[model samples]
Target chain A: MTDTRNLGSQTSLPTKKLKFHKPKIGTAIFLTVWSIYVLIPFVIMFNIATMTPHEALQPFAFGWDEGIQFKAFSELFVDLCMGFTIFGAFLNTLMYSIPPVFIGITVGTMAAYAQSKLTWHGRDFTFGYLMFCWLMPDCVGMGAGYMWFDFLGWTGTPLPFMIPGMFCGVAQVFFLKSFMSTIPNDLLAAAKVDGLGDVMVFWKIVFPLTLPAYWCQIIFAFIGAYNNYLGPLIYLEDPATYSLQLALRFFSVFNKDNKPAVMAGNILAVIPLLIVYLCFQDFILKGINMGSGLKL
Target chain B: MEAENVEALEGVQAEIVERQRKRRKTVKIIKQDIIGWLMGGWPFIGAMIFGFIPSIIGYVLPFMELHTFDYSQMEFVGFKNFEWLLFNERSMFWLALKNSLYYTVSVPIYLGIALFVAVQLDKHIKGTGAFRVIMFLPTFVSSVAMSIFWQFMFDKTGGFNSILGLFGVAPIDFLDDELWFMPSVIFTGTWGACANSVLFQAALANVDISMKEAARIDGATERQTFWKITFPMISPTTFFQMLTSLVGALQVFTSLQLMARTDTGPNGAAVSVVLYMYNMAYQWTGPDYGLGMAGACGLMYQTVLVILTLIIFKTKKRWVHDND
Candidate 1:
């Protein structure tokens, strides 16, 4: 969008004016190769999912001769069960992912609103505290979280994953806070003059206004919970309660001979996220930019 | 006299109403403050319980001999676990530490490649948006799935070897060979470089075009202008990217876990610190919580070092131009 024609025109020096130019062939070739490299995994995943085991070993066959074997998906859903089927794992992933996102967003929105809109004592301190919590890696807490869950007799249940999620989503709080800070103070003041209390004003004015940011937060939280492996691996002893990610690992381990089935499980585990990325690509990109754009 | 009395009564009524209004306003302000506290207080409390308490416990757990989950059984053992990890010649901890630090080499490789690609993509190009999406697609895939995909590709009879076969080159065992294993892992790590590249592209777009043009008019070459004008303008973003990439590299686990099948592959070359800690805590011959806590403590020290380094870089922010 920068006008390259007028770019060097302002300078007194007699130089050639810069002009917007098409991407050279070399650039196109480089990007094409990079794009192929990036996409090779998905391509391989799909190809192997359709292939018979013998054909899969060939490494080049697409299994198109058999015309796209949908049987692998059926097998993933129906045949594979160490204790529970992949369908059950999918449902379990949803259960673990959705409620936490819901709770996290609700809690995050409230905290962000309070930090950005409401004036109170200890507000800045609390915001800083949340930021500190955000900075610490999540894995550092795994050992203690496991023990804490064990103490509360909550291990082998979804509570270990969901309970902590309800309380401490510092990332969500930070993202939503940054977005909320952009809202004009006069808008909230006008709402206050109309007899709207702080809570009502947040609910009516702030929440709706920051819905785009919420969407970004929701996608990120959902993807995180859905793809989480370590949390379930450490805390949940019950095979029946494993999320799709954990289940996929087990599926590959247990069904080592069935490469097609393992590939099918992999594809199934990634499909929801793939769909999310494809649909909300712009929002996801914006979220990544916003996150990176944050000053320390 | 009657009219004057009426005016006097009206004035008194107005005063009463105004006073009542003032009192109501005060109460409403009080109520709003209470609401603010109610809304804001829960998250902080939750953070304390879930975030702060656990982190504090994680720090202290290293110093305590945790025989079992029971707090009553835990005994204080100052620096004993650390001594075992650091001083004991037979500890896998040293090898794991070395491998973990080595894995950080991917940070620069990834960033350098990403910055290069991003710079190229920043030019006027057709279908750049589509190209960006294609490039970024791999990052959205789950790490486990991608690891599996990579494992298949790196298999002895996999596509990579098959492609090499066409060139009459001998097949190499990418995962099993000691020399090749870490590079394979680093290669897999670079697959997610698109995420960083996209971020770099955004940063590049935000650089001041006017400054770039002025440099051009001053007869500076393209490379010099980029280095002198564009790079410094985006230094803050570069710093952020470096910090995140380093932090991420330090905690590299999933690919190693999946590719190595939870065993450190090929001379313990693929064992990251987190994966080592995970094994110590859960997959050890027994649950050695103290040793695992020691690993966590070590990770904390590393994190602190990273933060300190970041702070030092932040102090040099004078070079970063704020074109806003």
Candidate 2:
């Protein structure tokens, strides 16, 4: 969001030789078609989300001719939110989401610091461990993970989702490690010379610098935690603890005939993600660039 | 003789002092290792429980007959569950295995589409930022939301067919029909191509313009210049993106699950291995084909993935440009 045109402009340097870099008519047409194709789903979602059931049933039809407006959303928040309101579900999701992301990133950054910035004997061995674990396919351990969580009495709670995340995946560590490599060794060495310890080095120096890199993963991990369906679906049995996804799933299951309300729920579920993205998109691009060792 | 004895004593004393200093250095290295492990390695506690242990169990559990979480009822089943997969007609494993394999391998087709778009946007454009955002908008939305959107669109009389009806064409059943299942998955994925294209964008930005400029001036066509100059630089990104996309697509759940009511699409066409296993783990009412059966299926799929991953990494030298 912060920058864009200068990015794509880099490769086409020869075009800069001219005063007018006339965008091809063909390109404009192609972009317009592509944009429409991409935007159609969003358009349909919004249009249908706001529509009355009758209006929604007619796919391309648009009319406010009958029934009260925003009725579907009202019913959604009122009659059919399954034990949790959309807001409650949102709160439940946040409760389930934030701790792990906060803990994970902190631990991940610290670990990444250890991997890339510090000197240690087992650094390369730990790197190998992270790579091996990162490549491990998930869900095969469904029985074991479930049994383990049950054994710990963590199945119904957020612990299953939260605690496991603190370790962070190889992807997060790898990206952060790559970004941290760009951190000059002498910079940390100089900090050490000034009597900064590992914790202090992380707090006062590395954290602020790595914020750009962390932002990318933070958004990804946060959205991932929020949008996680299977974990919540399996673990949380009580209606009181249903996340937005669970709430939506139940609502849609019983209320499939109420298409607009379901769509409204879907719309509400997506808003937080959209806000997170709109706010942090620049960081995502910048972070990816910096993380991947691009010219930052 | 007294002078010689004093010199020898000094030499021995120096050696002892040197040994102490070396021990101190080793101690310091060990201290750093402890600190590093505390910071980074502690998370492996959770990884061990949630990741490693389960993976180990994943391999071993397939050999057992403890269907439910009641580990007390465990029994050795050997290759019986694996045999059931091959022999049983009721087993959804066949179609599911076919679907997952095709879905995972078809990544290059969708990736090529994203790369094509990335290439288009890179050609000296201005004010294309809005388009970039629109393209990427779907990735930002939760997959559940995106899945719901696609679900409605692919509904028999939903948006896609409605649009088709306007063109004097027969309305197509994008969801219920098995033939359009993979196409629907690929089509739905195109909205999120913005996610895949971002890396390519970075790769293109990093491409050295001077090399391309040199080739262009020497009568190389745009396509020729791309192949010779721009492509070699971006192939690494392509390789990395492809690997991640394959892994991610293999675990396809929330999206495909949402698109169809049965959550597997028509005849399990959109059903991925993870979803298929999920049914066994929970939904499928079989004390017979419970979590143990799912484990066997999951173990098989994971082994294939691990093998595929190794093959890809081994063959990296073939495709990935070694500019570094």
Candidate 3:
């Protein structure tokens, strides 16, 4: 494991060890204020989520007065003539998001494995083409995608959102390719010599070796899919098919009278991602470092 | 004589086995090549269909005067769409373009704040890890959620204004006022500044400690040591961060869309180019497909501009230190 706790201590200076160095008072004060600024929204969101609507409208105060109204959390599950419940939107989000990420990872890994390990005609050309495509602004393709989807009568369906994701994601492919490149070609050659098929070699050797890359891609894919508002907004007209983002937006807009419920829904929308980030913070940080380092 | 013959026979058999193994290896190589093709081909086809083909279509779209997705109806209009976008009295394109470019001002602000905090955290202060997590927490939240949360905070009777009221100042209409709208957007834009700082922190950590020690031993103060040694060492990372952040800022849509709530806020003051494109394509009064396509073409030009800027910046690699 990286010495994340002692990041500054990696220096060779014996006298300037991180553990021994006392941080200046100015630095401490700045960090404290910054942290408060960063965290206050979340604290207030949760705090307001536990309050009644009337109390929520009041200037932000901490703690529960009437024993933390769990009503909004429960009420989110109960459909309020808003065409769909929060639970249903969550499920729709999962349905729309999961398949694409699954396909993206699989296709991205396969392509990366091929580009990194296997020799094939046009491999370099294909890699270059994909990189170019990746660098192109998303808007460049989005208009055409909208037209294409409309042409195909796939506009109202989840096909528009899922189909693109089922393809190789550029970032995932690049990250995994770089990771896979680090694994010696000799190991793969040995595996082939052992009578293992290409698929078996990938599953047994290459895939296992690139688990960190996969973890990073998976987390990113999940977050991207979950937080996707633009996709669902453009594609889906049915409220039942709306992702949590759309649903939350709709709820907040129409149900302006209920602040606590809106806050509760916001918290619900945020918690899963928060948990994923908290759990895999190390991998995420390492992945970012690896990405930046690769650019360098 | 019989023993010698037996040894020669065994040698012949061993050679035959080795030749067979070599033949099998060549066949396996062919098979692996086929597998590689199959593995790479699927995504290549997908990219062609979804990525390249659509981009080409989008590029061609602005030149055509088509009301709908029907290609049969498309009339080649030449530079008319471009002319309309540039010179038309009703076009919001210029305003959107200006606002979008203005949004990039936040990139340096974000980077500066992030770098400062990162330097502070790099000092190995107590509970820096906790501070790091707290700071980065906002980044993981959805843009919509963050916008909504900020909407509450920026409300006239909201917590932010209430606090200002305590200080005997009039409540600022952050979202409503044209003057304050961009600032509000920029302020909310900085909520996830810590994400960049995390990357900066990592870069700072990986800076050559020996150089820092040399500077310190030579009587360089902490600030000087940082400015002279550490900053130059991490300039490459700073460049990367700035590039990505600029790209992201130019594509600023979600926060503006959600915060502004409807129609780009107070005479389109907060209208980003992407948001403008989205509205043109999806939510405009008549859904002018040509105009939408023109907006997309505009976005492409902006992207090209960004890439060119990046290429220019990349030429400054002479200033970037390679620690390795």
Best by lDDT: 3
TM-score of the candidate numbered 3?
0.88
Instruction: Report the number of clashing residue pairs per model.
Output: 0, 0, 0
Winning candidate number (TM-score):
2
| Tens digit per residue, CA lDDT, model 2, B129-188 | 766666666666777667766777777778778889889888788877889877887778
Weakest ten-residue segment in model 3 chain B by summed lDDT? B287-296
True contacts kept of each: 0.47, 0.48, 0.51
Q: TM-scores of the models, in the given order?
A: 0.89, 0.90, 0.88
Worst 10 residues of 1 chain B by lDDT: B286-295
Q: List per-prediction Cα lDDT, in the order shown.
A: 0.77, 0.76, 0.79
Q: Rank the candidates by DockQ, best first.
A: 1, 2, 3
For residue B85, model 3's alpha carbon misses the true position, in angstroms, by 0.6
Model 1 chain A is weakest, by summed lDDT over 10 consecutive residues, at A1-10
Off by over 4 Å in 2: A1-23, A79-81, A294-296, B1-23, B167-172
- Model 1, runs deviating above 4 Å: A1-23, A59-68, A79-81, A137-139, A287-292, B1-30, B67-72, B286-315, B318-324
Candidate 2 TM-score over all chains jointly: 0.90
What does the lDDT come to for candidate 1?
0.77
Candidate 3 lDDT, tens digit per residue, B1-324? 999999999999999999999999898877866888789766778888876666677777777776654568777877777777778788787898899888888989999999998999998877887888777776689988888788888988788898898889898888899888988989997888876787888889888787776555545578887887789878878877777677778888887889895687987897887887777766764535444454445555556666765685678666565655
